[model samples]
Target chain A: MADAKERKILVAVDDGLESLYALSWSLHNLVSQTSNDTIILIYAKPPRTVNTSPDGYLFSPDMMASVDKCRNDLASSIIEKAKKICREQGDKEVKVEVIIESGDPRDVICQAADKIHADVLVMGSHGYGLIKRAFLGSVSNHCAQNVKCPVLIVKKPKSSSSATGTK
Target chain B: MADAKERKILVAVDDGLESLYALSWSLHNLVSQTSNDTIILIYAKPPRTVNTSPDGYLFSPDMMASVDKCRNDLASSIIEKAKKICREQGDKEVKVEVIIESGDPRDVICQAADKIHADVLVMGSHGYGLIKRAFLGSVSNHCAQNVKCPVLIVKKPKSSSSATGTK
Candidate 1:
């Protein structure tokens, strides 16, 4: 029934405290216990490097293999951490799906949200001050600009005594 | 009585379509019909200028009064528009309040949210890309970092079909 249908929420995740806090906030504030909500977790990685070797240098498959393995391991751990948080939240009706894409996050997040027809796209801000963000750029801001759905960029409360912090 | 508590939601509104859509989204998606939700609408205006005249002239009291009246009228219209939206939506339990503040938004917003002990602070993002935001800065971004509560920045969706129209 349409009244009982699940609301799909796409949340961008990384292995950071802010992202974890966002996930926590969603579980308590946004996610409904009986609504069978679907939460899509996405983590974006850089594209594979196949660039030409430096001058007088040759490509090394052995080194490349190790680098690939390291990257894969990190991705696995990060996804696992997110999965564990979802489980701990104990929302029996909520469904969580993990996706790891190779590309810039600014592009991947918007595309994924569009493909999923997400009700809302959630993320956590890095909270970089004015000067720092100018140089590094903000993925949440980019997703907000390009995505076709609503974007929620959660920031951790600045004080320990904040209402959000108590929860 | 405690269970039917009023949730303080501070929404920063402007003349932009994005901000209007944000107000719409909140009424539909965030505000609970069953609970008593208090919506605080804040409009930030530039501080009244008593600066030295550009042509090295003196300040005129009559000119200043007229300028202040113009600003006040503008603020009244914007707040009335927001209130009309709420009334049209017909959520009887929700209470709407209006506030007009002067000086820098980056500072005023965070301070107001803190003083209100707001449960959540909502606003609309202009969605400037990385380079533009770096040089120009963002009021919502700054409030997200400094406020003690969670911040929700709603961006106008890219497609015309979405509730929020593109620039």
Candidate 2:
């Protein structure tokens, strides 16, 4: 079945350079792998906390609307930027689906992949140092362990030090 | 350098079924990718602790000898098993080098890759769950983030129950 062609490839994106590399790589490679492949660009939105009263109810309709508007705006901006990159790479013909879900980053990515029956999950590794990683383990690592499909973690090219040097 | 025939591909062994799959896949794919690629089997030996006085000085030369023996035994056993796997796969011509180093797994693996100028690093994703991962992230993640070369993380195919039922 290796040659059957993966129909769906999921690209999990965070505000990271490596994730962008993964997106670019997916735009280039997925088309070669399968014409029917769909690129699902997923962004995990962090949940907003609303202070609750003793009655255990929180957030009025107006406040909820404002929060929803902010979320939609953020999601749309990310999607637009990703689309621009895809266009620049000249893979506009490849189907791209932008998905924004609220929850833990790793959980949302894995759940979305399963829900979409993704054959491959493409992502970038935010290579944190040993101390940082020991305290706050990376999301990419968590997803790789939990996801069902193969995870292609595109590393930031060494020469592209300008992009990944800070993180 | 992309087309340069990979002379050596290092596979880290950690006594996991997923690792076996990764090893098998690497053997098949790397050999197909290049005609004369070698497989280097590396096993990282954990550090040994010598008995120390209350003031944190070494106990004695005999204690140091015991620690060295323990490290050697651990490394040799893993190397022996890896060599056996290579032989069973009929890769005598591939020139396997079984290396053993006493240090962190990620550090040792990266050092081995650099020392040999390995073209690729291959390992398996153990599919640890959220709680376990939160406690201790997998080694595959650490290697992927820290290593300079390309890393291929092969995920274990999920059982039907977990695949179909869980998020």
Candidate 3:
């Protein structure tokens, strides 16, 4: 029965401790040790701007290539750290998949969830205040509203609740 | 050890299939059979309005009592149905608690979650569009941002993704 329905749980992670905390929570809470569930770890890198130069300064070809490599390296490191967390916290039998895409994190996460038909999408809340969240729209909020599957927004305990302002 | 920490999971339910679907999903995906997890089912009934007259017509004392009784009955029925679902879907060992409160759902849910220090808050998305959601704020969305704990917003499969409009 466990093998019959393999749930694909997509976890969006980043450098923030909040996202990593979410991944850990998912491992301990959602993924069953004996079940044939697949954990998909995704990191959305900032989109590369190899062609466009900020402040009208044209980038050399080598500079552009180096910048791209730097982003790729960061993405790989994040994924590796997430994988380690899964191995330590989750069952060994659970399959883990990795995805590194270059785009807005919100778009990348929602697209991947829909494309993979993920049973659930797990993410971390940035815990931004009303003014900040209004200025810099929350990625988790966007995905929660947009994603087809269930979206789990994990808030780190230390972060203050955003609703305090309303009260 | 599963016994070391028994998570308190708060699930807010209503008459809609969306909330019930969320409860079912939580039982299957979050609760471990062997763990001594407590599932708290909460239903927030619309606040009593016995004193308010809508059309300048005072409600008689008996009429107001009947109205209050009717709301109470509805709340009891909803809670009973939710309890039955928990018994059917969750493991027998898992503890179940029920709460029926009268107030704005957003406030009732957030306060209960905070008061109990729930490990996770589960809710169902109403699938309201932008205009509708704006006109009538989404309780789940409000709770997700306001609740201190992790929030799991389950979207019924048939409900169209709200992200499609922006796409």
Candidate 4:
């Protein structure tokens, strides 16, 4: 039997409504099922670009700082929104932590799950089919395969009107 | 660019309405988009249990045969049904095949994808949460993680009645 008191739930967030649905669903379905649990929201920063010079040098300090600031701002806003949602739906005693990591999204998520010993990973599938995903692989798929813990993939509901739309 | 003529699609089927939805969705979406694509329905047989006896180590022939028959019946029926749906939806040139292998469903699906060089994998997510999934591990998550190809997880819409019931 699982000890709800020790359960840790991790949600991987992307900039999309589907991810938001997953967050809300996690709070409603997973959190409501147990009185004692913790929810952690994670946002993975995009990779930093290095400009190569003729002499094999990278970007200067000023350029690096500007890029870092942009990443921090983006990560902070996402975490703030997730925190607001958790506060609204989470239990008073349930702990909620916001994690911002920089690296490949899938790698960051899997590393965090392992480091924290997460009980489960909750994420949403953005419905990228083979060809589209061939060029841009899915992070959710990567995390699901590599993580030792159980993973819950939330699928976005299909609209009855059309087969394709913004997920 | 994706060669609509050379795409191979793998559909994972189980004993659930959601699996049926996945099957239908794959045919409607993939077949309608391509005429050269091949659809393979791979059914992973349930694991067999071993029993020890005083006389000798004997296999459970009866149980094994029964399970095999059921799997064959399911694979054939689903393929026929899928083909019929494709024809009804005005896609008549798509080729479909059935494959039944015995092992873990996730492993079987991944192996089939690799063997066939599948372009995409289509499966269904039940949307079970952290605790429920902890108790009952999800096969969709397993496939998403292990398969090399992109996976499309179909979500069934929550009925309005069920939504109200929850509230």
Provide TM-scores for the models. 0.78, 0.60, 0.87, 0.48
Cand. 1 TM to true fold: 0.78
- Between prediction 1 and prediction 4, the one with superior DockQ is 1
lDDT string, candidate 3, B75-109, tens digits: 78877877777777663456889888888788999
Candidates, ranked, DockQ? 3, 1, 2, 4
Scored against the true structure, residue B150 in model 1 reaches a CA lDDT of 69
Q: How well is candidate 1 docked (DockQ)?
A: 0.24
Cα RMSD, model 1: 5.1
Best by TM-score: 3
Q: Of the candidates shown, which would achieve the greatest lDDT relative to the real structure?
A: 3
- Candidate 3 DockQ vs. native: 0.44
lDDT of 2 by residue, B1-167 (tens): 11223456788876455665566645533333223567888777655544787798877988778878877876677567666665565323466877777766667887887777665677777623345446556677777877875566776565532211111
User: Model 3 segments beyond 4 Å from truth?
Assistant: A1-5, A91-93, A127-136, A159-167, B1-5, B91-93, B127-136, B159-167
* Tens digit per residue, CA lDDT, model 4, A46-165: 777456656998779888788789878978887787777777654344578888877777788999998998766777676234454476587677766677655666554444222111
Pick by DockQ: 1 or 3, better one: 3
Q: Write the per-residue lDDT of candidate 2 for residues A9-104, one digit (tens) a residue.
A: 688876666677667755643343213556788998766655464598886888788888987787778777776666666333666888888876
Report clash pairs, candidate 4. Answer: A145-B145
Interface RMSD of each: 5.0, 7.0, 2.6, 15.9
Off by over 4 Å in 1: A1-6, A33-36, A50-63, A90-92, A127-136, A158-166, B1-6, B33-36, B50-60, B90-92, B127-136, B158-167
Chain B TM-score for each model? 0.84, 0.70, 0.85, 0.71
Candidate that beats the other on TM-score, 2 or 4, i.e. the better one = 2
